[model samples]
Target: MALTPPAWRHTLTEVPRGAAGVLRLAGKWRAMATGPRGRGEPVMVLPGLFNSDRSNVALRRHLTRMGYRVEGWGLGRNLGQRAIGQDGERLFARIDAMAERYGAPISLVGISLGGLMARIAAHRMPGHVAQVVTISSPFAGPPDATRVWRAYQALSGARIDDPEVRALVGEAGRPLSVPTTAIWSASDGLVGGAICRGEDCAAVEVRSSHVWVQFNPDVLRAVAVALAT
Candidate 1:
């Protein structure tokens, strides 16, 4: 049995909380810059499945004000392999270009599936990525554990059980050469929050619904805290 997807109660609460997140983002966005400010560090924020860089504008915008040099992937919508390349060569290219442009390792802040990819990218190109911060990304559990499995298959054009994909997912759960922060919520409705915790990462709980964990004002503070330290 899939030990995830949360309970019916949590799943049911997603829509309402997710709706509130939008309002909170617009009105309570100041918290995003409350933590330790950045010192011109290169930070890249990756969008979730089916999302584009546009989805992260609020978060990235504040990060810039906090003093970090922030940028979106600029690769357009995230269609899994269609965007990152079958072997993730495209992701590697992005990392390489950013590292070159920044003249230093870049920090990766990813939401949901994007977080999984960020972890994988850090592993593939060790030291190129300074650190990784995952928001509600289930890298530490079976991909099927999430309610988004069918959506993943439809969008990524790959099965969760496919040998190659399985290997990559497995790799993402392992310890990284750089620091990692796994920010998840027990109140999440779509995926198992437990699965989001990495083996050797700093785990933070924000008690949010899965749909908009990335947009929550408190989540913004969490991200700022993660990057600052």
Candidate 2:
């Protein structure tokens, strides 16, 4: 049986206003100024829920300039729950294909729920996955941080206590067989930073909004470091 989380867990809310957004951009510049160089295998960028591949275009271009093979999730518009089925299967297949084409394992860089999905895919296909880097993902637990996410969970029939989701989350929190890095922020207006914790995961705290994690420079630098490792 899956463990039931405390009711207060669902009350963690998004940061009021968009302060996190401003801080995110600032952190990006800071990362550019001090980040280390990148040298590693290809990287797969997974956008957050309700976001599209276009969302990480800037980050991808930047990483590409830094000498990394950066690719997107190629699926169409991110329509949240709907993207989890056929689209997800196709995405996983693409990861497999990319691994073969590169002749090397691929690193997964997922944002928000996409991070959760990436972890699941990595676990399912460890051979193709080199490293896992998540940005503000709630891997430690369920979607109980905000009313919107709770509603999404209900509407999508994603029971936090469901055996599958629970099992996935539990495994995600355990030591990843491959290197793993989790970038989190106390300023995140969506998921709480607490869920970002893991014993085997290298955790980096950046100042950014939950929505702007893909664009945050510090997070990207941390991702680059993790991939280069």
Candidate 3:
């Protein structure tokens, strides 16, 4: 099936929902621990485009409470290739470091562009990555399928059809040896959810606009379930 950007209605609601998500934060982050507990496994939480590891504080805290050792991407802000490097060597190094430190594979949980990058790590170094969870990431779709395509192009100074860019995108979409889950929502406003998951990957649906998908309570619960089982 073909992929396209989300409709204007969903896009329009993103801001308000983002605000609401912040308020909703007051409710119950503890619910995340109800599902299951971790055994101090290293888990990396990757932020979306233009966002820093700071963006996923709620999720990270919840995961930590669930017994997993969660850490942010450590890289400042997510500027796509600019942040991860031309061939993603920096991201690979981060994964390698975590794996070596833990003496075990680390799970990758990323939102939007971060999710795409997470899949690339799993594809390129499956042994180091135990599993992957992509939130609202359109890795299985074309760049234009998301509202951020032009912004991404501007940030990276590269066109979507560039040969190297295409190769990099190809790496992101390759099948992985580890458990891979794609979490998306039909209510998403920035990117079409249809493109978020490939047929080969497990899919979980939640209700959220693109801006707050990673922070939404239901999304947090979904992430917990994905990581737990």
lDDT of 3 by residue, 15-101 (tens): 998778766766765444587777888999999988998889989998888889999988888888765547477888989999999
User: Model 1, 26-143: lDDT tens per residue?
Assistant: 8876645565998999998989999999998888988888889999987787876565447467778988999999899999999998898899889888878999999999898898
- Cα lDDT tens digits, model 2, 47-109, are 876678888886787677677888998876554445545355787788988999899989888
- Backbone clashes (count) for model 1: 0
Q: Name the runs in model 1 displaced over 4 angstroms.
A: 84-87
Q: Candidate 3: TM-score?
A: 0.95
lDDT of each: 0.86, 0.71, 0.85
Cα miss at 218, model 1 (Å)? 0.9
Q: What TM-score goes with each of the models?
A: 0.95, 0.80, 0.95
Clashes of each: 0, 3, 0
Better of 1 and 2 by lDDT: 1
Off by over 4 Å in 2: 1-34, 79-88, 146-148, 154-163
